[model samples]
Target: MHTCAPPVETLEELLEAHPSINGNFGHLLLLQKDADDGTLSQALRPYFESAHLDARQAFHADIGIDLHPDAGDGDGPAVTYPGCLPLTTRKGLFGEVLAGLVTEGYPLVGEHEWCVPIFLFRYHEDARNYLFSLARRPERRRQTVGRLGSDFIGLLLDENGAVIRFIAGEAKWRKTLNQSAVDTVMLGDLIDDPAGGGARVRSGKGVWNDLNNDPPVPIGVRQLQRLLQEYDPDGYDAAILSLERALVVREPVPLPRTDLVIVAGNASATRDTLTCFLPFEGTPPEYTAGHDLQLVEVVLKKGEALIDAIYDSLWSENADA
Candidate 1:
């Protein structure tokens, strides 16, 4: 039986309510309230042993993380620091705060909760290496989409034309990734044979590996194009645009079998529209610089720009369509 959780407004409140999440760790959430424009600066505070609030404040100011959004969301007012005090009238501080938490080794738990980031100290370089190793491959039509419910991992190709490997991970710094979470990401890509010997149909006769009788089939972008033309002809342009955006962003091309897209930090989404469509799997939290964080950010920003441009160009082309 699953136990229902309560809805808490503040980060601190959530930590207090669910201690077992993300390894039973507690966190210190910090925010600076600016009296002038009412903007706020927010980050997680390091634990303090002393009872004095001033001591905690002094320590936190000395060492704290800054929240950075993935890409600029158009023009807006400036957000301040310390109390996350208002320097601009833009209400974007919350998004930045969540982004900061993701960078500081925290994962958004669900639609509302985030994993607690306590005792998760990083020496920076190690964390950077991890981030860089999580590098994503550019999306291509030459690759294969797993199935209806496979875990969405980005593919990386070697110098050769063949795919070498891919990247997929779960950030449970706050909560443990159970079997369900694991299955959610990997269930769709079910190949009948892990070894290249035979083809096992989902509910039919299993066949022996007969390369002479049945030549090894190569799946490529032409197949993908055909699939789009047949099933999602209306979204053919969008699909092509999305594929190009993924390539420009250096992200993996998502499977077309389902309505999910893998965005930053291995997060996934099911939105149908273009802009609102998330580019990865998992919750939509801002990811921080690990190792290749900067590179990933550059690719993501470029991809977003490319997608927007494509939509504009297509909109004009389809003025009559």
Candidate 2:
């Protein structure tokens, strides 16, 4: 369990105070409170840009690779510019925002000491280019990779550096938050149980398999593995034991995992802006079974336009040049 108290007394206070875009897993009402004329954009721009840089570095670092300059001048490699607002860019931004929220101390899980969010994989053309150019993985050039896992994977750790749980996240930004939208964000059969005797015996393209297995673990998972091996090898064994014990604990045993859902859209009509509500209220039992869930809803006054506006403002210079 978290030993630290939350920074804000109430969810409303959290929405009003911090640059909410930079944080994770809570209700956020944009352009509603804090009546300052230009505060929102000013606060979000720097965080977004920095996060973009950090994400690129982290992704490369995960695969034991380094990025070289497109045109080196000897000072160092020039930053790789994501020149336009692609779908991947938007998805990456959402992951970074969620990570910021976790780093800023929003509890994504009830019984974990802290959650560290990582955005180390990309499933788009830009990432493919980076992988091929740097690692020489020509096979990955035309083949789709990195799409089989969660967008943001959070390492839920206890104070002793033992990973107690994992949070696999999926973020969606749309004008509507309806049933179809929720289904889409949930990633169809990816959330299904592999052992549950169905046509799909294999785990679909999702984080569940990655979290349960070794060798191919995500960057965040590897970090925890290293932490355990370095600090407490016994704790590592105990963690695995805990998971194994869950098999016989009950009929529907819960995995040491959580699902993080981030949904952003307009919500100006209702006065209740920062309330904790389940976005996947009517999701299928198979989709949500055996996992704890955390949801953060970002209600923008401008709705879907808010995302495009932020992207344009952040990338306009590069695009124009």
Best by lDDT: 2
lDDT of 2 by residue, 1-321 (tens): 112222333334425422222222233322234332444544455445544554355445554434553433534322233323344455445544544454344544353554432233433445545543545443332322333445555555565544466665655565544544444444334444655755443233332333234222334444334434444566456553433443343552344666555665555444354442343233333443445555555555654344455554663343212
Give TM-scores for every candidate, taking all chains together and pairing residue i with residue i.
0.18, 0.52
CA error at residue 187 for candidate 1, angstroms: 5.9
Which residue runs of candidate 1 sit more than 4 Å off their true CA positions? Answer: 1-7, 10-117, 128-192, 195-321
True lDDT of residue 78, candidate 1: 26
How do the residues 112-142 of candidate 1 rate in per-residue lDDT, one tens digit apiece? 2221111111112222222223222222112
lDDT of each: 0.23, 0.44
Model 1 worst lDDT run, 10 consecutive residues:
290-299
